[model samples]
Target: MMFLVITVISTFVLSNESSRIPFLNGDNFSDWKDKILLTLGCMYLDLALYVDEPPEPTVKSSIAEKSSYDKWKRSNRLSLMLIKSHISQSIRGSIPPSDKIKNYMRTIEEQFVSSNKALASTLMNKLSGMKHNNSKSVREHIIEMRDIAARLKSLGIEIF
Candidate 1:
């Protein structure tokens, strides 16, 4: 019972908000991806994004090779944890738990990083038709329109 309590406490303490970079969430993946890369790059662990997905035990692997694999696996796990920490709770289930950081990131990119033409067109129409209402300042309205253009541009549909 004592060990169980300790384990639970330690897990909570170690996995809490203090360890995360910031909230990236579901709506701002482009900026969030860049932020995540920058954060991990500063730590010199950004290469974990390209590392092999899972570490496998070699039947006749040399000590050096095995050690190298283990090191990469640890970094990969760190990358995965960081990604998981920043993922918005609303879209958390999109990325399943996996050992390979490359595949995990790939899956996330495919699922949430798309630049659909339909979405871009909708944004363009909305931008052109946007009006400033009494509740919002002109600054707020312009920022919202600029954000839509930015999103459209990010999707390769520039309308500047």
Candidate 2:
């Protein structure tokens, strides 16, 4: 009885942790990707992200090889599902589907990397054109400027 309760609670906690990954809308890919990677790592499901797929087990495979293969397979399957589940439906249609987690992630990165260049340009223009305008508190205005700078930095652009 105690074991069953612990199992249920652990499952819920894990699910909740994954749920914290933000839905990948078209504009928020960078933030969404960061959260997804972090969440997968926390769940110990990021093995597929770092390791290439192992060859299928053969009849004479050693126990350790089989164990490693099984672990990689499970991680790939669950990580793929967790990633796809968090993508918004509108964006999902454009991504080429794949059973291999690495391929799927590559497709996602390809789709975003190009747009990030354009996004950086836009942010640069906005940051340069921004002015105090006297409508908001000076603190709020400075914070907003800092946020734009931070976003630009995340895209590999540094003003200094």
Per-candidate TM-scores read 0.68, 0.87
Candidate 2 lDDT, 40-123, residue by residue in tens? 887788999999999899999999999999989998999899999999998999999898888899999999998898899899
The sequence of per-residue lDDT tens digits that candidate 1 reaches over residues 1-160 is 9999976865564455335556756556676777777766655456667655445668888887788777677678777878887787867775676777788778877776453545666788898888788788888888888888889887777766
The reply for model 1, stretches above 4 Å from the true place, is 1-22, 53-63, 114-119, 132-143
Clashes of each: 1, 0
Q: Cα lDDT of all candidates, in order?
A: 0.71, 0.89
Q: Cα deviation of 71 in candidate 2 (Å)?
A: 1.0
RMSD of each: 6.2, 2.4
Winning model by lDDT:
2
After TM-score superposition, the amount by which residue 141's alpha carbon in candidate 2 deviates from its true location, in angstroms, is 2.0
